[model samples]
Target: MLTNKSSSSSARLTFWLGLVGLPIGIVAGFLAGASPLLLCLALIVGAALLWFFTSFEQAVIGLLILRSSLDLFSGLQLPSAFAIGINALTILYVVVALLTGKAVHTDKFWWFFVGWVMMQSLWVILLPLGGLGMGAAFLPSAIKVWMRYFSWLMIYLLVMQLKDRVPPEKLVSLLLLSLVAPISVALMQIFLPASILPSLLTAQAKAGSNVSGTLGFPNGLGIFLTMFIALIWWKLSTSQKRLPWMILLGLVSFVFVRTGYFTGIGAVFLLILFINSTKITPIRVIGVVLFCSAFVYMFGSTEFGQQRLTEIYQTPLLNPNIDISRAIILSYGDGNSFNWRLAHWNYLIEAWKQFPILGYGLDSSPVLGIKDFRTGSGFAPHNDYLRFLVEQGIVGLLGFVLFLTVQGVHLVNLLRSSPPKSDRRNLCLLLLALFVANLASMLSSNIVDATTFFLYWWTLVAIAGWGNEYWQTHRLTQSA
Candidate 1:
């Protein structure tokens, strides 16, 4: 006598219960001296249950949380953990999307980008097979490097599926909330003695060195915060609750400066200038002028800041008397970070000459036997563009450039097509700012190597996509 709807609900409940209980039963049986095969079966069943039961939203949030929590285990240096977690969650999300019949939405340009990436990956893989094959010792690392690069595509696909389910604003809010942990860790690092801090939350730093926060490197933390400063400032500008947002912005900026990353500081200044140029108003102009004045004053007041500013404007490279190549080699011995980078760049440029088309394959820089003047060993060039040039070659670099260009064009279109003062336009502008800031940071830091930074970068891309789709849908609905 039960209704059809009630019977269907009961069936669904029973099915889920069985799915959950089966894994537990398998685990219990294994604990009770069951065959080793039972343990393997349990693992498979558990993985399948996790994949099937986890919603897309949950997977997205879980990925973000897992990335944020990585700094807590910095001592382990477990990048493999990040690679595995991200890949697993992404695959699971895709499987769920397919099962739910959700369309994998993407534009023609995006498809082309994906196809190009695949081709580059294939070339890198086959390059070794075609020539002096990849060393057995280097094979696993090479595969990992490719996986890390490919993960960005997976992230984009997963977020695309959730474009309608998750709003861009909510994603940004989550990111803002995630900042709390790192900021708090930074604050503790500043206040507490190094010996007193938990090893997991602190890293090796020079005596009296600036706080690095959860990222473990002071410059890295500065670069990370710099990427978000413009976006936060944008939010501050649009927000009604000015006092709280202003306070938060001040706190983040204070942490940013304390990291003592001169490049990051310069990048922030450039971003401010860019924002001001985009929309010049009387009030905005005044505010920008005041900000610039304060910025100059703050740096001028401190000897360290003044020295950094001087280095930025007048490095030894500009001197005609200094032989650039000799100076670069000497810089490694002189302990000058800037000069060391120049030397690395020089080496990488020379190395690129050997494999100009496809390069020496992904992650080949460390093992390609190029001499590192600093440590008497091979090392990755700190500059990302050089890394791409040496590792992936010209073809890889062009593919990357094209991808960025297409993304930039799409963002610009979204910015222009959206109504003035609309959420979509605002979000697009913020994403653009974040993208430019990260790109600027790449000159000095291989920002993409860090999993957290990777997450932040691609999440911005996803949010931009979300904004575009949301706006288009709203326009169509209104017209209809």
Candidate 2:
């Protein structure tokens, strides 16, 4: 009876919306002399927005899927004012929930990050008043950069809140289901000749120059894949329908091999060794590791991988090398290479010393530019550690440290409380492994604000976080 009533209401609402919207749209289109395509797109977007606002559950699920997939039009050159994304939508959702008095929850890591962003904002806001030469013009860009992390906190909290409303398995299932689009694109990249496809959609030479799917670059795509695979690892542990997951697992693994990101391999290696304690034995671990290593060696060692390995293994002789610090001064030309990054990092450290405690204000590191060997150009810091110290100073670094510290607590809590081979315990292990891989990757990659990667990563974090509390309370009380 309720279902029928809901259906009847939805039907009437849609009918009214179409009736009202169609005439307004036609009039606007006619007045503006708009094309059919433009009008149609507007209508579709309008309908989607209406649906998104009207239905909370479906809206959140759709947002997850869309975030995992593409803003297929993202690469297009558009005005900043026209931009809309998961980050923007998150703020809107939270605001509406608050205004409507809808209940929400936050987790352990939320306030620390929010507090940090607030502090960072202070640095940005104060720099102008402090006569730092940088104007308030930078505040907008700083907020934009800040939004990525802010959304990350919201996503983690939102998922933790959703635990009671949605089943844990279903949440994991949503993540698994999110894999289809990227996987299909990856498979397409493998079979199709690269000459025909858009370069923007593919990986670089180091990553086989074929597959990145919807993700714009190799490392970002690799990170997302590693995170999602870790989520699947949690689900696979206790699934009765093992064959389907195993099949999906095989495909993701095959694609991971094709990704050719060194980190992905290392991440999988970690998972194989320590996914769950009860399921782990020295002999079994050794066997599986060897098998995977052997298979990867046989299948994953493409021409690019071999050549890349040779390059990395060969030592540089600065005496006769192009990469040698020939000039005492570094220029923008000395960019993107490993030596370039080192030179740039040294420069940032020196510049950071000028404003050591508060640093050169927020977002001030890169714009310091290639002032001899004193700073990098308008490029990412490439090392998040340096980015924190140089940009947000000690406060930023401490906030980041505090955020990671909470993860460590959760890791210890889950590992000790939940038994080996159990769902919650395995999930705990996967989150820690993924977090380690991400941190290690951060040593060389400016992945702190990698949007697509975090969309998947925080989902895993949220799941593990919610489980941490639920299992601890239940098990401890029951056992006592």
Candidate 3:
């Protein structure tokens, strides 16, 4: 009787505490205003509390959701919220883990990865003392640029630490869940009234009927949806409930096609080829042929698709009737976005000739006033490879290449060694497909600039590495 009374008293006390604290917290938030620093502080505190109470897997899922859906909160004018919240949570999690003696042990692969990242950071830090001095005015921009690149390193470390804590299946589920909001918002944009939708979530007029979805640009949306198609395709292959996944795949693919981004389409086609490389059976070949035929028929029939194809083959400069000057002017105008990219690539090559070793430093293109043909103004090179070549130079470029090569090798090994029907093997195949898709997308689009896609890419890379190590160790233990 006494125990029951005590339990009831405790429950009442907890209920009262929640009732009082909820309003107090709301009032405090309002009183604090929406200053970036204050908002960051509140987010950090809330995230820290969440990290402490929840499993690391849950925290990771929440972080990914925030990273992906940040554009939804742009109306609040808190552009830095996503970066600040992510970095704070990551730092806090690392600090807590270290203090509690739960720090993840590293292997040689991690050491090499960290060393390469540090080398890039060292070059960026010494930039002011080197070629172009970093001005105080440009310091913040440089830091933000550095942070954008460095966050991938932090993501890798976080995933490595949680490798043992979270199961692979759980991680996959969380990733799919994180994608839900962005995909839903993208779908809603097609049907919702323009006035009801956030401006950033809707397609811009300049995109020429291509939908940008929540990414604010057609190319960004293309990269994201293409990756989703690859992932969902793999899921459908393995899942018992195929209908739902097929529906999602169709929706995302339709939106992606509507974006009119050729790179994404090419990437998906390449992924399909890769998936069927080992199987050349008659039925498989027929299926592949039919799929390609149907896709081509649908795409070629669309007005935007017809226009894009015409632009590719019919350059105004190639016309014999136009004078040289008139041809140049016409080719550089609004109708020739592809020609603009070619011009930007040419400019980047010339810039690379100046500082071929350790280029102008991170984020130096805007600072140094690199000419962008796209807008006849200054902007970073649209090509990621070109950006690296101009910003970090040959050493940085090589290091990045090595990082990618190592990941590819690891994934291939994992796929070859794992059982064909195992979950891990399917995941490896999916990651490889996504990697190839993004690589193709990066040729013309700045793949890294899309925060959600970039984060998703690196997270998959880290998870693949962690899983490879886990399975290898398990095999060894079994043999012993």
Candidate 4:
């Protein structure tokens, strides 16, 4: 009855929202003096509302639209506007929840809380040291990084508090919805003329090509796609529903090649096959074979596709020239690039021989010319772990490793105690996928993209604790 009441209330809310939205949209169209396209969009919204009778987070969408408009006026970019809108909505949601006394912290809050406290405390400690200017050069970039971290941290608190507010089905739905926008952008890129394709691609290179989709980072885009692919595969293999998800999966895979990160495709196939084989039937086996065949046909045909596979195959085996081979591999077999990462690692190890204790203060490496060793570019090591070793010395790296070790150990214990059939399994799978992706990313990128890194990291921390929360909830319900 309560469920129905909520549904009915939600339906009524949608009706009123649409009823109000139509005229307000018209007023907006006239007052703002937007283009005909904007006018048509407003009309389309009204039509969609009338036809579908659907309820959406109208307030949030309106906020995003307003932000985009503001950005257009200010000559700021679209992605920046989108990011601002997300941050604004996320913070507003958390604040409102807290004010309404609905928010609660998770058991894992201590991990995130401590991590935040440490970062803040370290910043205070490093302020007088003046070493932070080295690697973290620009004031805007540095502040933006911290702001991203803090925004995601707050988002973590919201998720931890509202775990019950989102059901498994809802979670699945949200994940699917998130894919729609990106998938659309990716498809547009795929279908666009060769002349226009370059303009569409974001700055980040997925397969050493400028084909980044909606996400700024190519690897980030791939990682996000892999997450959805995992979810779809899970649902297709486990749930009775298959056709809808299977079609969606196919569509996603096709657009996936737009980035040309074949590794992501390979990872998806391997993980899906591994999970599906646990209960593999004749039909399932045939499905896997068909998917793999399609993947190969589509991906292997492209120049970027052929190059990635070639690189993987040509990745030099260990020999007396292993360092030389590695340098070639990192630079995509280019001998002229100088590949400073190796030299960066060598410099850090050599420096550790001196002040291994506290070493240089945070962000102090560039000041000492750590980056000037090989490339003359004065860049940090591409590898996050190596960067940690360089900047923090042996002690700081160990501290970071210890932090990760604790998280890993805790996850293992939680998974071991969790029943196989429980929803906690999803949490475990998601975390495991994220962990693997982070690990893979760090081998080549920086810690800024890794396990302990961004908003997603904090969100995962809260998610890791959800298993125990759900278990407790289940036990109480059973008792009742």
Candidate 5:
């Protein structure tokens, strides 16, 4: 009887799997105009072909190069199989991080990061307890977004653990070259005709000059341009090929300006402030201030620049002091981007009251109807602060804020301690500028959800934060 029961259970499992797969097989056959068996064979063959060229390490590197260049996570008009591949790859990454124990570092950043992680993890339990009622329908998207956050955390851990394994000079050189493909492609997309490249390389078919570069948005492209430019300058500080790199910098800056986004203004300003690698003296600061003031005055004298400044405001006149808080609150109703933002923010603010402690789960913002319904297609909340407050609630937001605070304090300390005109100081200034720019950009963009952004951001965090110590340790070990 026991043998019979085992056989019956195994048969039932096979039957259920077949029942589930039958529809999928039929759909594949109908869509491809081929037999089900042929479609199945093709899938297996394709997977085999892909597998031959793929490995865990290779996938991660490709993620750096390709993901930095493309917006794979956007889920826009792509194949369903791509999503499956991403999910599988993320699972593999998480497994590796866990098995290596790299995710459990005892650093202060780890404590804050893990606290935020734990809060996100608790969403499954929290979202259903008279809260947003975390539905099964949203699980796939939720998991994907959660995976993105986890991927960032994992990369930070890996960098922290392995910063000593590679030299900065070699890595920077490799990246400077590897990044050329994306930058070149972006240039073509913007300056050349879209017909010049295949559809995979150019999304400008429907929309002329989709300045998204490979990342899928103009601002994203702008962010990328500024980032790589900064990296070039970092390399230039120590590089022998100063003239050629300087020319490249000029060309890239020209492209960045055409992007027409001020997202990197703060970062660019900071970079200009310390471009000489001189000590941070008050005189140096005042000179930069005066120089910027003169430039602004000259620029404002131009007709186009005056018009641009006028367009930035144009919010209807309001009471000067109806109590500062009330005046700010009333400003949200103005007819502009601010109005759209306030609409979603107010909606989110109200929704958070449902579960004040833990608002909703990761990726829950989309389902909350927070997107702009202006053109019938939804829009994302450009602000990261609102994203954290609504999705992670107070605890998650607090943890995130604390992590940022730690980052700020650490960078300030590094700046003060590192020798002026040294590699360490230059790196610190570069990292500090990016940090400030990134924070400012967060006020109106989703810089966090970006893939290459995190890779670039975390690498600096590791290097500027603790990579030097690791480098010193490596040197000592080698010398000994």
Candidate 6:
């Protein structure tokens, strides 16, 4: 009884409605289930529905996964069985995608493969007995290796597909929100009689004794907020971006100061360099004076600021007392920890002689072994490059160097070709901030262990691709 046009309209409406309904239903069903296995299945179903029905679903999922990853160090509170089940679900999703021929392709496959090879290379290089002793001694090494990179690959694939769908503004918004959400929640928790705030502080402080900030020892969160502020400050000052972000940054800074995390002070200075770099005359001088005065006032406070101030400049290594008032310095005028880094680097450098090709399997540090290193609570080397050298040997390190070098060169070229006043300029600034932040994190903390490392690398690359596309489109439009 209906015409063809009416029939088509009905089908389209039904399809659109289903698209919205299915994802909600799938996610709800998954969360509603008490059984871990059933929940995992529901997550997979939700993943599939989201992937198929939404345009920016990949980016959304990627961000969700990354946001969830802060839990990597924070206890999941899930049973071991449940964790394994989730891993299985992830694997199943990948396999299903491949079988269904929805497999995303990328020219960057080699770079991804190199990442895997680097992990495998660890097996042969670091272990003294050529990794044979590792399996018998540490069966869990295999699982740990998978845990580090599997989700990363899936996220990369998802990003590759959804790169264009995630606008630059939205990307910026997500980061701002990540910082704001935690700060807001933590602030409220401070007033409320909640068990979470105390527990969180205790755990995070133990992980790194130097942490001090409003959200309990704010090592991770502080660094994260600082980075976001830098990015947002640049965007807001340079472009007509949203005003809420400026307000958000102010709130975050207040929390950082209130927490007494001295590291955030350094991070704020680093951010200021980019934001106020152009102001060269009276304002710059005034800013510097104000900064120094504020720093002194904050440092002078005993009850709130003393603990953080002491941790800020306290150097490890060479100092007999762990709580030295000032950073220890060697006779050579280097920070004592600076000397230790050189010493450890030298040790790894010498060890590379034995296995120049494949060094050692994943856990090269003492924390992974039976005994802790002299450095205290030993784990992997704090330096990402050194860790790679120790674990994967020269071969894997070489591949990584090449990959990063090419990416760097590409970024430089892109920046040079684009106009300074263009929107694409923000990408360049973001890249610069990330490059500096990651470099600093590598020098100070174990970058790879922090959830920051994986997210930073993937997000930078995705944004780079996004910028490249925009540049190309702009050129085409001008030509037309």
Best-fitting candidate, scored by lDDT: 1
| Candidate 2 structure quality by residue, lDDT tens digits, 97-141 | 564445567655566657665655666667667734356777766
TM-scores for the candidates: 0.82, 0.75, 0.79, 0.66, 0.68, 0.65
* Each candidate structure's count of clashing pairs: 0, 0, 0, 0, 1, 10
Off by over 4 Å in 3: 1-53, 72-79, 103-108, 133-137, 193-196, 203-208, 315-330, 366-377, 468-480
Quantify how close model 6 is to the true structure by its C-alpha RMSD in Å. 8.3
Residue 21 CA error for candidate 6 (Å)?
20
Question: Model 3 reaches what TM-score against the true structure?
Answer: 0.79
Tens-digit lDDT track for model 5 on 140-214?
Answer: 666666666665666665445434445554544555654566567667776676767666655532235335556
Candidate 5 wrongly placed segments (more than 4 Å): 1-63, 72-108, 128-130, 133-136, 194-210, 274-310, 316-335, 367-375, 412-420, 465-480
By TM-score, the better pick of 1 and 4 is: 1
lDDT of 4 by residue, 80-120 (tens): 44455456655655554444343345565456555753663
Compute the lDDT for candidate 6. Answer: 0.52
- Cα TM-score of candidate 5: 0.68
The weakest ten consecutive residues by lDDT in model 2 span 471-480
In model 3, pairs of residues that clash are: none
TM-score of 4: 0.66
Best-to-worst order by TM-score is 1, 3, 2, 5, 4, 6
Cα deviation at 230, candidate 4, in Å, is: 1.5
Q: Rate the local accuracy (lDDT) of all candidates.
A: 0.67, 0.63, 0.67, 0.54, 0.59, 0.52
Write candidate 1's Cα lDDT for 1-480 as tens digits.
447756765676566567868978866686658677777776786675565455657657666755655666656766567666667766765554454444566655458657865865664566557532244455667777777767777767666766777777667667776677778888888778878988665654444546678776777677778766766776766666667876787788777776777767667777887765667778777877776676556545555565556554434656565566766776756655676677777767877787787777777776553465567777666777777777777877887778667877877776786676665666677767666876777787776676666667667766666644565332211100
